[model samples]
Target: MSVFSDIFFGGLFQGSLYAMMAVGLALVWTTIGVFNFSHGVFMMLGAYFAWQLVAFGLPVVIAFPLAVIVMAGAGWILQASVVRPLIGRPNIVLVVVITTLAAGSLIENGALTVWGPRSKQLPSLIEGNTTIAGVGVSLHQIAIIVITPLILAALWSFLNRTRLGLALRAVAQNEDASQLVGLNVTALYGLAFAIAASLAGLAGIFMGGYRFMNPSMGADPLLKALIVVVFGGISSISGPIFAAYLIGFFEAASNYYFGLYWTPALLFLVLIATLMVRPEGIFASRSRGLA
Candidate 1:
């Protein structure tokens, strides 16, 4: 019973974090019609920025928002300058590869130049532990668990209720039609990228509490985000969230029963099985926009 509780609660904690990261990646892909390979760098930048701010005596509350705002600005700049130039080009694949490689190089070298090659840690917002139904958990972990759903809910409301949100959805559905209807498609794309980058920033801040931040820290979340996006279905918003929790639970269970070495293998097997059973994802039908 204790083991089960640990796995269940622990998986939920980690899964929620992954969902935050994956949702941002999905948003960029679905709304802007570009697969942002540099998303991992955005996350890395957020973590590093938060660390730097906090080190300068800023509160976590202030630092988090600052990091997000900076990343949002960076996203806007990237869209306006680099991505926009390739918009009408016939070879989108080449553009994607070039952008990704450029982003990778920029992030790595920028971090090394700015912060040097060292791992940094952000202070936890919530300290100590709490118990639930006789299960013990860290307060920081609980904050992560709570924040994930709140962010998701906020995003859902924004995308479904606001005028700008509706415009974004329209742009995602058909850029040409959206432009014909007087929507500034380019601005919408920039907004989408900004929102996505903001979400990634939040994920980075949360990640810093639990893990050390370095240039390479983004790699794990990047891989996990890709898996969750694929497993959940690219076109569906809720799919990646569900898939994240599922993968988290599977990882916890594998670690508990078979030891740490087999965890990756187990997860890959589950991914294979999931693909075989539901290639379109378990919640693929709920996908918004064109099918």
Candidate 2:
């Protein structure tokens, strides 16, 4: 029973973090029709930004939000400067992959030069531990479990209920049609990048709260998020969210039965098998919109 509880809660905790990381990737993929290889660097940079602010004597409340804002700006700049020019070019998909990969490398090196190789930790929002179903868990974990849904709900409302969100959704569905309808497609693309970066920033903050963060900390999460996104399907936001939790639980079980080192190998194996069976993803939709 104790082991079962550990797996259950551990999976839930990991699933929440995976959802945060994967959803942003899915958003960018669906909106721009390409992947940002630099997405993980955005997470690393955001966490570093928050850590810097805290080190400078700012509170976590202010530092975290500001880090997200800075990341939003970074995202917009990346879209405008790097991605925008290649939008309609020949072989743009391959070009974007290369460019974003280069950009991510540059950013990671920049982070290393700026922050050094030392690992830093962020203070948790809450301190203490609690018991659930005969298992002990940190309050921070509980907070994360509770807060993740609320953030996701707010994001859902923004995408489904707001005008700008509807516009984004429209652009995702048919970019040419959106432009024909007088929508500023370029600006919307920037907005999509901005939102995606901000979410990645938040995920970084969440991870930093519990784990020691270094310049390269985002890479693992990035790979896992890619797996979750591919597994969940990038056609809609809901698909990745469901996939995140499912993968999270699977990861927990794998970790318990197989051990840490074997987990990544197992995940990749599962991904390969899943792709062989369903290349489009388990919950993939025929439609191309974020809804």
Local accuracy of candidate 2 as per-residue lDDT tens digits, 1-291: 999999999999999999988988988888888888888989988888989899999988898899999999999999998899999887887999999999999999999999899899988879899999999999988998898889888888999999999999998889999999999999999999999899888888888989999988888889999999999888889999999999999999999999999999999999999989987789986543332
Total backbone collisions, model 2: 0
Q: Which 10 residues in a row give candidate 2 its minimum summed lDDT?
A: 282-291
What is the lDDT, from 0 to 100, of the residue 26 in candidate 1?
Answer: 83
User: Cα lDDT for residue 42, model 2?
Assistant: 90
Candidate 2 structure lDDT: 0.90
TM-score per model over all chains: 0.93, 0.96
TM-score of 2: 0.96
Deviating ranges (above 4 Å) for candidate 1: 133-135, 286-291
Candidate 1, 1-291: lDDT as tens digits: 788898999799879978988888888778876778777887888888888888889988888889889989887887777677788787875787688769767876889899988788888869898888678988888989988999898888888999998898888778899999999988888998888878887888888887788887777787888888878887757788888888888778888899999887777787788778977666677444433
Each prediction's whole-model lDDT (CA): 0.82, 0.90
In angstroms, give how far residue 117 of model 1 lies from its true place.
1.7
Best-matching candidate per lDDT:
2
> What value does the lDDT take at residue 89 in candidate 1?
80
